[model samples]
Target chain A: EDQVTQSPEALRLQEGESSSLNCSYTVSGLRGLFWYRQDPGKGPEFLFTLYSAGEEKEKERLKATLTKKESFLHITAPKPEDSATYLCAVSRGGRSNDYKLSFGAGTTVTVRA
Target chain B: GAGVSQSPRYKVAKRGQDVALRCDPISGHVSLFWYQQALGQGPEFLTYFQNEAQLDKSGLPSDRFFAERPEGSVSTLKIQRTQQEDSAVYLCASSFATGGNTIYFGEGSWLTVV
Candidate 1:
């Protein structure tokens, strides 16, 4: 069965501290890997999309890299406002009609100022 | 609206009662989806709609769960005889016609079955 797993169910980081979140997947025909940031009571906001191994993308303070079996989201000196649940999702590689995402239980990061 | 929108941000239903959640996708978006998210867990796919056609409903938990996107626009997810286990945030998402496109999510409707 296809599976997506994220490590460190919860992370507490001091302001300006850095950390990494992991998302491992065992799915066939990996089409895309996605990263999202979600705040309490709000839906997830798009962060990055990596299509293949060794691909990387960066935002203001977050960087996401993908490999064949897993993906990592690195936070660089995160701030209190950066604290939120980071989610990783993957979609099967197939026809254009197959667009559903399989997600892992997200990692909740709390950055204290 | 500028983004995907959902109605009845919160709902509380008695067990055995029915509830309906509404979703208005971004204007002109070709694909719409519904997901259920339990507390402390990630969103799980429930169904997908490509225009007015219901393309995928396999992820739906049970036959009591029904979704529709008639007229190729606004959509609704209806749960019959709500159960306590049905309590979760129902999320609606939309994307372009092509595959691998970024799927945008709405604020989500929080349903609590008592």
Candidate 2:
């Protein structure tokens, strides 16, 4: 069974404080891993997609790195506006469609000024 | 439209009532999808559509949950005999015709079964 587990269900960080969220996975084979940020009462916004191990992607103050067994999302000097629930998802490499993402429970990060 | 749009941003239904949630995919997006997200949980896949063709409905929890995309651009998810367990946010998403394209999602339709 393919599963995704995110640690530290909720995190509180001070403004300008840096932190890292973890996303661990177990799957038969991996096609892609995706990261999304979702705000309250809204759908998730795409952040990054890593297709292979040892790959990384960055956007603004956020950087995502992937490995064979886990992934990490590093936030650098986050602001209040950056607070949101971060989701991790994976697509199976076999016959599973690329869009059929299996998501984790998500990690909620709150940044206080 | 500029992005995927959903109707009835919030809906409240009584037990045993049927509710229909609508989704309008982005213009020219060939693939559309429906997901159910419970509070505090990530969205779960409910169904997938490709140009009016219902290719996948395996993730649907029960037979009472039905989805259709008759025109390929607009999709609807109808829940029959609503139950409290059926209450969740219904999210609609769309993607391009091919490859690993980014699946864009709508604001979602919040359903509360009382």
Candidate 3:
């Protein structure tokens, strides 16, 4: 069975503090890993997509890196407004018509001023 | 060229009632998806559509859940005989193609089964 697990269910960080979230997966074949940020009462907003090990992508203050079995989302100098639930998902195999994704339980981050 | 959009940002339905949620994908998008999210959990895949074809409905929890995309641009998710366990946020997303790695999502429709 394909499964995704995210560590640290919830985290509280002070403004300007930096932290990292982890996402690990077990699948028959690796295809793509995705990161999303979701705000309260809204759908997830896409952050990045890593297709291969050793690949990384960054946007704003967030950086996502991928390996053979896991992915990491690093937040640099996070602010209160940056607080949101971060989700990680993985597609079972290489890109195909059946691009089904299994997602982790997400890590909630709260940045206080 | 707006992003995906879902109707009735919030809906409250009584148990045993049937409800329909709608999703309008971005213009020209070929792939559309539906997901169900319980509070505090990540969204779970429910179904997938490519153009007017329903490709995958394996993730749907039960037979009560049915989704259709007749015209290929707008889609609807119908839940029959809603139960309290059916309560969740329904999310809709669309991408340029069925195999695209990046997908854009709508604000989602929150459903409450009373």
Top of the candidates by lDDT = 1
In the range B1-114, model 3's lDDT, one tens digit per residue, is: 688999989999999999999999999999999999999888899999999999889889999999999999899999999999999999999998744358889999999999
What order do candidates take by TM-score, descending?
1, 2, 3
- Judging by lDDT, tell me the better candidate of 1 and 3: 1
Which one wins by TM-score: 1 or 3? 1
The TM-score, computed over Cα atoms with residue i paired to residue i, of candidate 3 is 0.96
Q: How do the residues A1-113 of candidate 3 rate in per-residue lDDT, one tens digit apiece?
A: 78899999999999999999999999877778889999999899998988889999999899999999899999999999999999998877755533777889999999999
Better of 1 and 2 by TM-score: 1
Second chain alone, TM-score for each candidate = 0.98, 0.97, 0.97
Tens-place lDDT per residue, model 2, A33-110, is 999999999999889989899999999999999999999999999999999999998887765466688899999999
Q: Whole-model Cα lDDT per candidate?
A: 0.94, 0.92, 0.91
lDDT agreement of model 3 with the native: 0.91
Model 2 chain A: ten consecutive residues of lowest lDDT: A91-100
Could you give the CAPRI-style class of model 3?
medium
Best by DockQ: 1
